[model samples]
Target: MNAPNGHSWHPETGRLFRLVIDQLQCTMCTLTIHDTHHAEYDIVDMFNMPDYLANRLAIDIDKSIQIDAWIPEKSNQAVSFDYEGDDGQDRFCGLTYYCRADPTVLLALSVCWQDGSAPDEWRDRREAIDAWVDAHLRLLWRSHRDRGRVGSLEHTLNLFDFTVIVLAADGNILFANEQAHALLDVGDGLRRAGHSITATDFDDAVRLQTAIQHLSHSDEQTKSTDAGVATVLLLRRANARPLVASLARMPPTARGSAATVLHVIDPDGETRPLVGELCRAFGLTPTEATLAHHLVEGLTIDGAAQAMRIQRQTARAYLKQVFVKTDTHRQADLVRVILNGIVPIKASLSLPANGGNGSARSGAK
Candidate 1:
């Protein structure tokens, strides 16, 4: 299918990769396979990324970002990708490939490339690139659906630092990625120890289930107002460490279609600093500082405890201390203060959204 953009698909992967490297003004790129429980896709190899200083920008793959796509029958899980040990860098970039309703592979590509020398042409096609990537995911899903577990996408999705899920019209747990699996697995108590529940156990997951039901039953206008996205942080890893989660409802429909997407993220990197910074800046008690940090950073009190490797009660004490010290009336104020203090370094690229709407997918095929 011809994309709204003019570029034609390249049948060969090698040719497509090479063309992307040459035409897109990226310092370097590679292709690889990404597999997970819910979704499988190919990845744009970062082979060339290491060669260029620009590539070192960490993609916060651990951070979860889910967006309710305005497009029909689609939603996106934005995974944060980041370079480790370079957290202080002002500019950051990561790749998040989009997947479709069937949970089939979508385009696997990097996003927000921070390379300073990147050409205008590459930047100009941002929307087209998104569209193309979306198309790739759909095409790849179609190509591989029959193969099942035996086949995977030419691209890859990171189990860690990424949120993978099969979206339905009503936000059902169609499927999930490795990271999602590790996160959602809830072990039974000693008596029922062996038993476990996956993503369905999450508080946000249940909320999402409720929201989906409401959206599916409600009319469009009611659903639109009622339907919204939320961010939730869950406990991840075999140890069940705390991570952030986001749940968003898209425009509603009665077909049980997903109007929203859910994302889970690990904010361990920003946790300590965020906490310590609040304490130092506000003279908060250590407990207050710690509690303030986690709460503001989007962790639940329980999640903060698990993250801090402390007991929930102990975490609660710290939270109270934080409240008293900060002299803040609400948690929202605390979050606002800290977020405001954290500066954002942004880079912009003009894409051919208006006239030059070239299709990057056409080249991929």
Candidate 2:
């Protein structure tokens, strides 16, 4: 690797700094470094030229090393790596650093150049700068590979209102953010046995499992370029109201092909309003509609009455009417009828006329 402007390598600021000050004039320079893990990078530190340049040079021991610009594509083309000036086309030269670690990190530095300066002056040092940057990346990657620590993820979760939970592929709870603890009925005492979360019944557990599976499959097929998908599932508790979980794929790219993030968003508002709307459209009275809606929501008659704030006798009477009007003889039958009746107007139009029956006549040719 060649050193910038024939100066020795300086760990304080890297080789790009000296080259910019010696070979170029009247320009501002910026240097930044970061780590890359989980297919992403986070910035670590930065420095501004001139002020930091003196500090960098003072610490250097070697005279100067010259390096060749490494072109990842289109080789032998001497292109000046612009540190800081305007290139007349409004494009400026910049350097980006990324570390390959468990969570990944990124750094970006911009060097603004003096206007109307010839490109050849900076081109001379391009090889040297590229070599230094490549070397820095190697060092950063090795450091992360050896060190295992959760740096920003712990404190960062507090900044968001949503609760973050990490779940293993086998439905075991790994960790939970602070918000996760407060929002759900989970804490150190209740979280024993590795089952931090509790659902109302088997159905709720199945729903969560299905959601996780769907999210995992979606994340895999979508590739890294597109925005990841969030899986939505209703997690209901016996004592507490249900929560809407927005499960997503988290960083470090799920080592075992699983969703890393399980965001449990509390469910807000009533769940039966849409069912009530359909009941009203089907000419059901408010009481009958309430019964029908709750039934569709998997509530028993007793449950529906409590929800409707009505006596069991009154609720039963309304449910009987709902069954009769909807031509259903049982609660399950009534639910099926009500759901089938609520087809959107556009969808109803798509149905074949005359109950899908076709008229046929005998004919002789």
Candidate 3:
């Protein structure tokens, strides 16, 4: 592998340094050597290197010899180096070990002293330090990789219009998407209490808790029979439509401790079916598609006509065309077809500004 740039330090490096410091009382630096003519490299120092010694080392070292000598043909070899300052008052000692997992990477353990005297015990403890590095190197790399994957997944989930929350087996909140956070912030039907999510209503809370637990802790035989199925619960709201929440178990092969995912859909939330999608799928004109969009958003025919500023008769004419093109004769079936189809899964142009009740002008083309 090529060398990481100066700014590219893995977060797990700090934890590894903490462990190393406790054992050796030395500064730990992980260097990635570039396969270049100048032997360019990057180093992660845990802020343990003193400013004076760091400046002197940068100004007074031969780049090739200082960096390239660390690369070993065998994994177990340890290379040592010592430098004396101009007055012979400052001394520096470092041991570089080859990384078994990545050939281009090197681990340098060093210490500096103001007086000529420095600890020689590092030489005796060389074997112990090398063994510790070999044992923890792979684990730290895995942790860094997993953290990156989780960050990417969180960003992807934030793009959706509905709420998504991931929970552990004990119903603790492991992750919550942007929409879920907003939903909990409002404290209407559902809210986050302490570390877990709960419904405001007594009965709804019981059902929600039970569903999460069952899906999270189901036995192997039960999981096989309902592997892909999601358990649905309706959470009631005093002022508006009830929220629909679907709970499902994360697959056994998933990496993290997240055992259940709750997907909550608010009925009054912004409807995001694209006008182009409706037109292409149902072969309706833009005007007809607009009317269909309003219906799917839970508007009655009169309400849709009023919202569109069209005459009642004109709206009825558009609805008739939409029904014939979509092969659905009733309003309920039209909504069912659109919701159950692939249109709702398409990315929305924008999120609602008012959290749940905001309206966006449909982009009809």
Candidate 4:
């Protein structure tokens, strides 16, 4: 399905790893895949970024980067290319390549070695490593692209009046919506450091980072217990209002990486977007969706009906269908289900008026 922002939530493309690369950079990281993020740990401190990447917009296969002592040469035979470490001061095992999603600059990684030389045995394993990196590179780029489409300012997360940050296990800030960027932009509260998220308050930073680190290292036994019960943290910015964040380990929708999702909410922010998601999730028609939204706002059925410009009987009819479809007889249970349910990316919430097969099909009523 799709969200109102037109980003699709589907089995093939999950929301979990959307900002994985960004998250990996927030902490000291080691990767078996394209290590483009390591560019932040670049030599020159002025821009504090690898000039090749810090200035570029995308990395296409046709173009290449000039690392100090090395040059990029695409290998039609292999999925990787080589780079000299620190302008040839040291030798490293690794290559750089870009993905279809972002082609202006290449991604990088280095298999370390002392004395700047690959061991004799390492030569035998080079082809295998290349194959692995090649296999995973494009997929990672796709994840970033998909995430940008859904979680970016043009999408649903930003339209709502809440701050959303997605992090990797290592506490790297992978993706932050528009609301989050504003908070980070002002120096005093929160901000982006080279490949990391930083805060003016040491305790808040430590607390959040620790939670994210914990989520990153969580085992199966602990993950189940931590799923719905999120860790809450208060980020007291320098001159801004304190931000209350609900931090949780978002279990992966598919296999591979999962991330820590931080939802920074305003004490009085409206939940209309969430309600819109709820309506689309259970096939609620426009009127029914409006009714459900009103209920979520703490209105009674009569009040909701009156507010939606419908008769109490019609509202009751819609409510009964909602109960049957949602498998809840009580209003509280219905509300809980909607609030707690996964916010799926779904198609449009459009449904016919007067509630037809919509109770069985879509939510807009």
Candidate 5:
């Protein structure tokens, strides 16, 4: 089973936590606080709650439950509270367990009843529930920690507008970000072949494989020299400009079995920086920022004007203002400044919709 939010849900592990909730005849919610001081946390999982209530709790968690008042001095400290919903009609009795093993991981086990009054049996079984959590705390912590780590990495990779892929020493695909998967699924230039990524053209495939092998088998000195420098290759496509691929070896600490990290940028694809980001970074108006974005995306002044549906002279005026604000006189300088600036580092919220292509899979492929 999957979580309502599409997170991986392990029924067996969930059942372990659900056992106590069943015994107590109440709904259960599990939360993990990555940073308690700054109130950075997320609901790891929940069980036995109606979809409406769960959604409401996820959105208005801070307003509904106050956990800042009581910081558990030690691990396995269970704190209980009674709180009403925003409308004041729906009431809940919950117990939050804080396990400060890492000073960041707080396990909140909310046992809720809707009627404002919890049964006497719940009070009597409180110690038993705490004992059960203590007995299985390590297992529970590992499950949540691993899930959060994977989810965070996937999200971070998806934020990039370009394609990112991780390859093993032998060129097996270990992981691919959302953009990479989409690009591969399109089968324009690069596509997944068995467990490895392959280019459509013979020469491109040879060059790509050679680059991956070089990075994979590089000595310590060569690796150090190549650090921060990528081996650039161009993958030939059927219609568009060749996709530019930058290959670099992963750091020793992070490599594990993965040898190379490949970042592919499709020149003809929509790789425009956000207009709002450009405006804030360069202190330009929305129109000026939009014009600057087009320039950075490889559109000439006339081309940009045509795309923006404005007069050529008006576009030139916007470009002049952009140059003054961005401290760049030439178009090349403008593109370089914007590309190397903080604009590209900003994560794009909008993602391409997944297609029906059958070849977009991650993990050992």
Candidate 6:
């Protein structure tokens, strides 16, 4: 295909530099390439998926040639290839350096030409391009070289504080991570059993179950632009703020069993009510509210006092009043009480009362 620019090929200063090749698809994942003078070009496109590309990149990398990954046998060194861009495109070229930090690379830098083949004058400008390539590659390598690697599943999951649980179509608990187990033991909010799971409200219980049932019967195995039917519900408590809970269908595995994934977020635990709201809810003075805010940020009593710019004696008095108002005895327990229970800034939530005995209903999609 002719260059989309509709001009004579000028490799030194042309559209080639815009063709950045960031993704290299393997047998594991999908990848789409941007080609031509525009990201929208689809006429000269090519597609391939198999093990041959992996094996080729492995051996050619040791040869110190332009053929890093998926380079054809006829290709020698690098820069631009005028004759072989999908048999219709004029040409393409760019650097394909490997990462020094590891045997595999998740990213790379490739600047290509879209309109025409590289000019014969590329020999004089090759050094400039080399400098550009070296600068970016070295920066990437140095940034990741010294930080040791630990990519275990547990390490990754422990980094998040959300409670996640996966269940089979029949409501059988399939997988529950460490945070999920702890949340289940917290009591009264969400309960898990060998057979099924339930929420505090009967209506919520039915809604969640029905959502999981839909996931169990899921047939779609690939992601699409169209949104699927998922359910988001708030796990409310009369005495404390609610948790945002979501249920979505996990695509079926190779063995053909689909499961439902449950996600719960406790954003309330990280929020502090406004000073007026805190004073009204827990009957604390302005100074006491300020102290409570500092404590909620995980500061010690002494630290909170210092943060609020108050004397030790005055801070102690404020803390005493805070404990009394919030109904907690110790600083640690007081922290939990304030953060998880007292002075919660809740949004007004109203669920329609359908013609049923229960006061709640599921807001499933």
Which candidate leads the pack in TM-score? Answer: 3
Residue-level lDDT tens digits of model 6 in 209-318: 77777667755644231124468888765567777888887766677777778888775554544333543356566677788888777788899888888898899988
Query: Which residue pairs in model 3 clash with each other?
Result: none
In candidate 3 the C-alpha lDDT for residue 200 amounts to 94
In TM-score terms, candidate 2 sits at: 0.32
User: What value does the lDDT take at residue 289 in candidate 5?
Assistant: 72
Model 6 has an lDDT value of: 0.50
Which of 2 and 3 is the better model by lDDT? 3
Write the residue-wise lDDT of candidate 4 on 93-199 in tens digits.
32233232243333433223334343455444555445445445555557656767765555777555567888876667878887788867764546687766765
Q: Give Cα-based local distance difference scores for all models.
A: 0.46, 0.50, 0.66, 0.55, 0.69, 0.50
How does candidate 5 fare on TM-score?
0.58
By lDDT, the better pick of 2 and 4 is 4
* Deviation of model 3 at 191, angstroms: 2.7
Q: Give the TM-score ranking, best first.
A: 3, 5, 4, 6, 2, 1
Model 5, 1-365: lDDT tens digits are 11255352454447756676676666656544434444444555666565555544443434333464455665667767676776768787676665554554455555567775566777677767676676565566777668889999988878777889988878898889889889999998899899999999999999988988888877777766765568999999999999999998875446444378999987775445443464454566667778888887778999999999999999999888777777779999988877776333334463222211121112111
Query: What TM-score does each of the candidates earn?
Result: 0.28, 0.32, 0.67, 0.38, 0.58, 0.34
Model 6 — TM-score against the truth? 0.34
Off by over 4 Å in 5: 1-136, 219-228, 253-258, 271-319, 342-365
Residue lDDT tens for model 2, 1-365: 11134322235344544554554442555433222212222223233444333223212101111122221232122222433323334434432222222233322333444444435655445455655554554554465434434646666665555567876555567777766777655532122234635444567666766765555455444546323457677766555666777777654354644544777654443435445555655557766777787788788999999999999998988877666566668998887766665532222233332232221212200
Per-residue alpha-carbon lDDT of model 1 for 129-205, expressed as tens digits? 55555555456455445445423531233313445554555344555665555545533110011221233345544
Root-mean-square deviation per candidate? 22.3, 16.2, 7.1, 15.8, 11.4, 19.6
Which tens-of-lDDT digit does each residue in 165-273 have in candidate 3?
Answer: 9888788898898889999999889998899999999999999988887887777777666555789888999899999998888865454333788889988765544
Of candidates 6 and 3, the better by TM-score = 3
Worst 10 residues of 3 by lDDT: 356-365
lDDT of 5: 0.69
lDDT of 1 at 34: 30
